[model samples]
Each structure stands twice: as structure tokens, then as C-alpha cells.
Target chain A: MTLHAIDLSVSRGGVAVLEGLNFSLSPGTALVLRGPNGSGKTTLLRTVAGLQPPLAGRVEGGGEEIAYAAHADGLKAMLSVSENLSFWASVFGTGDIVAALRAFDLEALSDRLAGTLSAGQKRRLGLARLMVTGRAIWVLDEPTVSLDAASVELFAAAVRTHLGQGGSALIATHIDLGLDTELLDVTPFRAVWRASDPDEAFL
Target chain B: MIALLTRDLRLGVRAGGGFGLGLAFFLIVTVLVPFSIGPESALLARIAPGILWLGALLACLLSLDRILALDWEDGSLDLLATAPLPMEGIVSIKALAHWITTGLPLVLVAPALGVLLNLPGPGYLWVTASLLLGTPALSVIGTFGAALTVGIKRGGLLLSLLVLPLYVPTLIFGAEVARRGAAGLEVVTPLTMLAGITFGVIALLPFASAAVLRINLR
Candidate 1:
């Protein structure tokens, strides 16, 4: 089986972010989404995750279940790392957080508040949340923001194992993740600059 | 659904120190009113309903910014937005948590505050009853406002600007019932009106909030 995004278009602030974009991926494969800062890589991931409404088109075989990690680590500052994992695990109805956190080397920091953790640590917590979601597809936006070389290696290893286990990932990132992944360059959809005009808001 | 609600409620109780901070503010406001307006028993009795309603409204307002700001900041909101459950359901459960922390406690404590304001015994029931019925509406309505403001940077003041106008009718009816009860007059009219507005908002505001959140998330 394959998940396909057909004729997809996304607009933000009345400006087209992406238009008529098409791609498909099957199990045991990955796609790396790359573009400049405003190239709509994040927007594509949001649309695929069903967080943003597509300006036009459809995503099939992805269904209602997909795990998404934005560039912002979404862990609550007040919540300890384990508590954050438990919250997501409970919501997704799959209590697999111990393994997920362990994979990110977060087991020791489980009781630490997310806000107290370093930037890379918070990113690992965010990825751990994605892992416990138990969704077939992972739409990740800059999943490796704060990691050093070793942590980045660990994340790449997790992705490789996930793909080997029949899971799929569509990642948006600037750095090379070293996964045997397909590349989708989103440079063609980049907007030069967005000018604000109330009258011309429909562009 | 239970999972989301349970997690939210637990987090609201355990990690939400801010919830306690809001309740203390509500208590302080309720206590300071009599001191400011003079301890004239008659005057205090006359304004007891208005004071309680206003206090509850302010208490609810103080806590509104935290409603979705935490989730939005921490990234949990996006996860909930993408969960298999509908966005509307997620919002509804969030409203429930808000009520448990702010509205429910306010209702439970209104009787005591009512007494402090020299309200008669019968008026205490009306104060609590109105709060119980009206606070859920406040939370549900407030969620929509919070959702709208979530995307805007530096939004707390703007949130009040957008939400306060919508709260006027509920405030009017809520305080009116308290005033009538203080006078020992029949209160079914204002009470029924408050319930009607609450019912209408609870039924309709979720869709509006969800639509706005979709835009904000983009």
C-alpha cells in the first residue's frame, strides 16, 4: 500500500505556499523534504498531518492517524519528561513511551521538567512523543534541531530502524539525516517575499 | 476521548500552579469589595450578586490566557489537532478542564464569598447556582476566543478585547439573578435567560472555535 498526496496546494496569508504538488511513498521507504526557509516545507508537513487545511487537493492512505512534530518542541515546560511522554502515550492509546524515550537516551531524564532540559534534550522529548503516537506515518518538521553529532546519529538510527520495520517518514530538514531517503526539493514553490495589503489579500 | 480528558484534568490539577494563583486572585477580589465599598450591611447586601458575578468573571478572565497558551507553546495542541478524534471534541474536553479548575471551584466557593458580602442565606444558593450554570458557558465561549488569539503574538490584551464583549450578556444575566436574590425577588427570568445563552453557546461555539483554530494553525 502507498500514501499519495495528489494535486496538493497550500496557501498562507493569501499567498500560495505550494501548488499542484504530487508525491507518494510506501512502507519501508522515507522522503526527505528540503527547501529554503520560506519554501513551505513545514506547511507541506502540516497539510499532510491534517493540522492545516489544504488550499486544494487530497491525501489518501494516510487516513486520520499521523504523528507530527513541529520545529517547536511541544513538551509542556511544567511537565517532567516522563510525564510528557505519558500524556502523549495516553492520548494515542499506546503506552510505548519507555522504549521511545530509551531510544532517544531520554530514560535518565524522564523525571526532569522539559523546560529545564537543553534545546537538544527538548527535541529528543518531542521525538519521543512522536514515537509513542503509534501512527503509521510520521510527518516531521525539522525533527533534529538541537542535537549534537551523537544525538543526531541516534535519531538517524531510530529512523532507519523505523523504516526497516515498515514505518514511513516524511521529514523536513536542512541538514543531512543520513537515512537512505528519497529527496523532494521544494525550491520551486518558494515565495520571494510576502507584502501585506488588505485590498490585495486574495492573492 | 477519556485519555485526553484524563490527561488534561490531571495536568491541570498537578502541574497547573497557575490555576491556584487565579483562585487566590478571585478570593482577594471578593474580600476587597466589601472593604472598599464600606461595610454598610445594606449596601453590601444590595451589591452581593453583582460582586460575585463580577468576581467570577474576572477570575475566569485571569485564567483564560493559560487555556491554550500552554498547549500551543509546548506543541501538545498541534498533536491534539492531528489526533484521530475531531478537533471539536478536543476543545470540548479542554473546556471541561477549564471548568474544573476555575468555574467549578468558583461555584463551590461563591456561597462563602456571598456571606462575606453580607448576602442573605437564600441569595447564597442563587449565587452558587448561577455560577454553576454560567461558568461552563464562560469556558466554552472563552475557548473560542483563546483559539482565535493563539496565532497572534502578544495576544493577552487583544484576547480580552475580543472576548469581553461576547461575555456581556452572560454577565448581565448572572449579576441580575444575584441582585434579585439579594432582594428576595423572583429570579426565574434572568436565570432562564442565562441558561438559554449558555446552552446556545455550548452547542455552537465549538464549530466556530475549530474553524478559527484551523486558520490559526496554518
Candidate 2:
């Protein structure tokens, strides 16, 4: 499968966060999205994941299924980690979460409420959700935000393993995943403002 | 689709202590009003319609903030949005959950609250009927507001401000019908208008709520 984004632009609150962006990724490939904070790295990932609508272009050539892990961790504070995984697994029509949990080193925390986990643990649990999705394209936003060196290594290993098994990923990360991934710089797409059109004024 | 609905219903039922809390608050507000107003039965009778409407309105307001906040926080909203179900269907399911937890229970409990306001017998039916017609609109409107504010910090009060103005028609006809029933007058006009408002909102709100939620999620 190949994921293609053409002429993509996204604006938030009148400010264009991403503009005129284009990218393509093939199956079993990884793209490391690099940009400074607020450079629309996450927005670009979201557009690809179909979480955020593109202000201008469209994403094409991918199947309906895409797994996304946003920066928020998006966990249920009250539900146990196992419960969260089961819920997501059911959502994706994949009833298995044991392998994902084991891959993410979250088997022990599975019985604990997600709120009780450490920040890194929570991030891993969030990533574990992607496994159950079994999606062709993995859209990840800042997936390594809270991980220590070891967990980061574990995440890189998991990504490599995912790619080794012919999966594709579009990851927006500040740090390198230590994999042979393509690099896409998103700084060119940042908003540029002019005192012209009122609607486009929030550059 | 059934799975999504059942999941949200289960989560809402288990986490909906606030619904009970809202009813308790309504009971307390009704009980305190007469005592504060010098135990004047006549005054209570005159204000009963207003009081019940206000109670229902506030109770509706009490839970609007939670309609989408918990789902957004828990990542369930993401799963829901991406599920096989359409966005409109998801919004309807959520609104139905809101009605089941808060609106339905409020209608069932309103007759007792009506008694506290010294409402006459006919007024109880009016209150119940008005609530049944009006509260779904409340949930639908509030669902739109909740979606707008889902990811924003300090959004609860803002959501109230955005949604309350939209609630006026429901409130007006609901209170008017209740008052006419209390006066032993024909309430058919106001009742029909109230039902019209409910019908209109129910027909239109799911699309608006789903659209707004998609924007917010974006």
C-alpha cells in the first residue's frame, strides 16, 4: 500500500499550521517527520491519519484503515489498561491485545488503571493500541515523548519489527528512531501571514 | 453500531453518578425555594412552572460538559469517529446516551419535584410532557456545545454560554404549556410548539453535532 498526500494545508483558528504539503510513502517504509514545536508536524500526521481534515488537499491510495497515536495518549483514566486495550481491539475488529502489550512491555500494567501508569508507561500503552488496529499505515504523533532511553530503544525495535513485517508508518518525532527511515522536513509549510484577507489574516 | 452504543451506554451508566447528583440538586433547589419565599403556597403555585423549567434546565446544563469530555479524554471518541459507523450515527448514539442517563431520569422524577413546587395535578402531566419533548433538544444542543469545547481547557462555562441562548425556544414553550395547564386552560398550542421545537432539533442537531465534533477533533 502507498499513502499519498498532495497539496495538503491545515489551519487552526485562522492560522495556517500546514500549507501546500506533499508526501508519499510505500508499504514497509517509515518516514520521520522533523520540525520544531508548533511546526505542524502533528497536524500533518493527523491529516494523513484522517483525524484532521485537510484544509486544501486530500490523502489518497491508502485503505480505509489507519492507526493513529496522538500526543494526548488518549487513555481512559478510569479503565484498567487491559480494559482500554480490549475496548480498542473491539473497535478495530481485532480481539487480540496480548501480543501488543507484550511488545510494548506493558503486560504487567495491563491490570492497572491507565491513570496509575507512569508517563512513559502510558505512552507505550497508547502505542500498544496501534497493534490491535493492524492498520497498513501507522500515523504517530510524538510517540516517544515520555520514554526513557530503554523504552525509546524498545519503541524503535517495535517500529523496525512492524516495518520488517511489511507495515508502513508516518511518525512525527523530535528524536531519531534509529531506523532506516526517510526524512521529511515540515518547516516549509508553516503559516505565513499578511495584513490582507481577514479570513487568512491569522498567519 | 450496536457495539458502540452499548459501550458508551455501559460507560455512561457506570460513570453517571453526576446524574443522581443533579437530581438531588434539583430536589434540594425545589425544597429550598418555598421555605425561602415564606411558605406562601399561592406564590409557589404561581411560580411552579418557572421553577420546574429552571430545575430541568439547570439539570440539563449540569451534564452537558461531560457529554464529550470524558470520551475525548479517554480516546474513545477517536475510536468512535473512526469506527464503521457514520459520524452522525455516533453523535446520535451519544445523544441517546445523554438522554438515557439524565433526560429520561429527569422526566421520571419531575412529578415529585412538581409537587414540591405546589403544582396542581394537571401541571404534573404538563411538566413531564414538556420535559419529554424539550430535554432531547437540550441534549442535542448541548452535544453540539460539548463537541465545540471538547479539547479546550476552561470550556465548561464557555459551553454554557454558547448553548443557553439556543435553548430559549424550548424553555419558552415548555414553561408556557406548563403554566397553561396549571391555569386549567388549553395547552394545545404551546404543547404543539414545544413538540415542534423538539422535532426540529432532533431532525437537525445530529448533523451539526457531528460536523462540529469533526472540526474539533481536527
Q: What is the TM-score of chain A alone in each candidate?
A: 0.91, 0.92
lDDT of 2 by residue, A1-203 (tens): 88888898876666678888888988889999999988888767766777766778888975475787777767777678988788778767888899999899998888998888999999898888888887878888888998999999988988888898888899988897789999999887786865556856543
Q: How many angstroms is residue A13 displaced in model 1 relative to the true structure, after the best TM-score fit?
A: 2.1
TM-score of 1: 0.93
Predicted complex 1: DockQ: 0.64
lDDT of 1 by residue, A1-203 (tens): 47799988876666668888889989989899888887888788888887767778988888665678887776777778998888778878887788998899998998998879999998888888878888878888988887999999989998888888888999988789888889999887554445665654653
TM-scores computed on chain B for all candidates: 0.96, 0.95
Docking class of 1: medium
DockQ of each: 0.64, 0.37
Interface RMSD of 1: 1.9
Cα error, residue B117 of model 1, in Å, equals 1.3
Task: List model 2 lDDT by residue over B24-51, tens digit each.
Answer: 7778888888888878888899999888
